[model samples]
Target: MDDKDRELMDRYVYQVVRRLPKDQRDDVSMELKELIGDMAEEKGSVREALVALGDPAEFAKKYAGESRYLIGPLYIDTYWKVLKIALMCVLIAVFSITLAQGIIERYEPGLFTDLGSIIGFFTHIFSTTLSSTISSALGVFATVTIVFMVMEHYKVDLDEGKNVVWTIDDLSKKEPGSKANVTGMSAEWTPDRLTPVPGKKAMLPRGDSIADIVFSVIFGAILIFTPYILGVVWFIEDDEIGKGVMTIPIFNLDKWNLILPVFLISLLAGLTDAILRVIIGRYNLKVMVSSIVSGFIQIVCWIIALKVLPIWNPNFGNELRRFIDSEFGAMDFATYFDPVRFSNIILVLAIFGLAVEMIVTVVRTLRYGLDEGKAR
Candidate 1:
């Protein structure tokens, strides 16, 4: 057969296998491909071989070996997979929100001075976050399980309609004397309608997308609620009052009023990328475009916040210097180091990191677009 015929066969196999459970997809794909090859060889026409297989949905149902239960064997594996994804997402969200709230409520200047307070602070937040996460997890588990059970019990095919039953008549309909439309199945069921099988390397792991969601929420929360956490802390020796703690904030508090919106935009961009990644489930042109857009927005926002705006605390260098000199005796701090320049360096590094991420996404998508489970 020609390349076009081979492509058609692959598409037909993809249609059948993709409807099966995730763990079964690869094995079924290989089996279906081999079966098609054998059938085509016997029939002398790939198209005829596919027609003998009947509707892909019908073929998949037979191959799936479905069983009737609260959650049938046909859907149990997929139900578990969905449950895990939902639970992880809820866990990340609850933990990040809980930690952010804790930071906002408990974080103060020199709060880290005492090792005991540090331990206590973490202990309290961990306990609170754990309890919250567990509660949220239970709710997520119940919701996902119920939804899957209902779908399974009803034999609902989401790709079709709710409780859809395609009869022989549905498959037999055809225009009178129309040679091209001989079968009951619609012409739309042809291999041309099949989606390209996503390459193995191109597949976007749900865990990675979920991780992006978690990090975006966490970093955004840190930026919005506790920007002062990223700062320098020191202690002062007071002859009468004993050792006192001090802090020099890294960012200009007033400038945060302007920088925050830009940061929010970046955060939204990251979330959009992550959500798209999860939905698409693979590296493709669309996913690459999203990654680039998100990375660009983040890089631009960082540049604006770090370089164009006076986001860096104006007196960070001076205040830190005074604290250092007073505590450690006379010493040249500014001559040796500069906080503003250091922040600029960090911005440069961040930009580099973001750029690399975009490039990697593009390269991975292109490199794997054609692999298409051949190695598997």
Candidate 2:
């Protein structure tokens, strides 16, 4: 109601307006100031005007809706929609591959048993790894596209008020190869005299060539090999079937020959995926290096497993003896350590690693993409 109260309201409006986008911020602030002034005049009291305008926080929220970065609202909305669809498509493709593998194993067991077996082993080894790679690539692509579209939609001028427009006469005044200016040598061409061009916003890294491909491949390979190496170490430490009686399946030692090839193929596939990502987009070298280190750490785990398992249980050695004897009987250690348990453990580890890698890759890709867009 009073001049004091109107001044307080003016301060409140100014604070709220400060948070808005710079391009339109001044206009919006001026409009708000004028609106408050008129409301105060009509209501006779600033408190009455404030009550009519509703809560200050709520008023701020209303204006907040107008604030956005270079990316317009429509583009952000569409980008998310398309991204979800693309992700769903990728998921469907993976599921279809899995289902096809299952069908081949079941219905045509005799027709392609050998081929099916080989395929099945590889499918298990690299399913999670491939999924992770695909997800990361998709995330990066989405980020880049969104950024590109935003830069296109909004003609964001970083220099804004600082841009200096030079006239034709100003350029002509500087003689063809003159050492000094036309201002009687008093005007020196210092660094400050030349207005700096605005720096471009950083954009997502783009892997547009062969070098990127190679980097991705190397990174992926390490990731794939790390787990298999761990598994091998686990196998070697508990080689005597009796030690893993409670965890392994009832298959001949000969059947395990399948695992070696599976591991190798998985390693190769992982390497390929990594290479593809590097080739297609930018990624952090640190992350790839860390993954390699993780693989080595996995080997150490295997060495630990070898030493620790036997010491943990006194019955470990005796269990092997019992398993050997029971082979002649109906009950055997092989039956105790079923294929399901072994597969489950391997799958769990693979899935965990895949998840971690995917998360890191996606986050990095998005950040790089956003930065690149800002630069542009």
Candidate 3:
């Protein structure tokens, strides 16, 4: 081979080697150089050597395959997997805390209230410090381990002889139906189309199932107690122990009117998101559909609660006097309908629904747009 050809081959190999993990880069470079040199000796020319080594693009692919535990082609290009796992951890922590608090209030009653100081004390400990560290460590470890394990299971090692048995360019140059052409074509095309991507078979833990309920209950208790502990400490610091003790009941007791709506919305959103993800397998569709559906449901519920509930009376004085003097005396008929108060309540709820829907719609649209842009 000519000096120029040799230099080109070395440079090409170096470029491929540079892409490999630092630990393996130098060794891979030396190995590739040796392999190319041996091929050149047998072929007797630089052009022949290059042909045997295969297309530079194809060669680079083969080089990557040498790593038995490569996460992905774009592993270095992006940290999306890391980000996703981190987000999941935060979600778990939040869910844990919320669920624990709810359960404690339900079953333990005054226990949570009495331990307000403990809850207050631990709120900062769990939310800000302990939860953050634990979640981060678990997220990173789990993400990395899962990615690498899946990659290895798929036999994505670059150095493996099976991956680079032949090249596409080499196959195209050969006559159709030739043994070399067939083998090369099969090797280059079949792996991607036939073999499912690593991690595709693995099942992610869903927060909707019985398992989630169990986890939430167990973790929720811990989180609820954390806040009360903190509250006690707060009271001690403020020199208002009596007020703090009284505040425990209000703090720990779950207000069904408030908690129910939020829980329903969140649960519905999560289910909708999961369903959309399964249907579309795209971020844009999942986010948009989930947001819209959840928002719509929330608005409908608000409307019903505002319009259907008979809790206010507009003309209390006149209606009460008439009822008192009527044949059906002492009946509380006027108390049933309060046009002024009812209208005000309905208006407030309607406005709230409208605002929520608008916010959700805008957010979903933006998320969809961003995802599409990324795909493009």
RMSD of 2: 17.5
Consecutive 10-residue window with the lowest summed lDDT within model 1: 167-176
Candidate lDDT (C-alpha), each: 0.71, 0.44, 0.46
Number of backbone clashes in candidate 2: 26
TM-score of 2: 0.29
Between candidates 1 and 2, name the one with more favorable lDDT. 1
What 10-residue stretch in candidate 3 is worst by lDDT?
165-174
Off by over 4 Å in 1: 1-90, 93-187, 234-246, 333-340, 370-376
- Candidate 2 residues lying further than 4 Å off, grouped into runs, are 1-3, 23-30, 55-73, 76-78, 85-234, 237-376
- Top TM-score hit: 1
lDDT of 3: 0.46
Ranking by TM-score: 1, 3, 2
Question: Which number leads on lDDT?
Answer: 1
Pick out the ten consecutive residues of candidate 2 with the lowest summed lDDT.
161-170
Q: lDDT value for candidate 2?
A: 0.44
Instruction: Please provide, for model 1 over 12-52, each residue's C-alpha lDDT reduced to its tens digit, 9 standing for 90 to 100.
Output: 98899887889999988988888888999999989999999
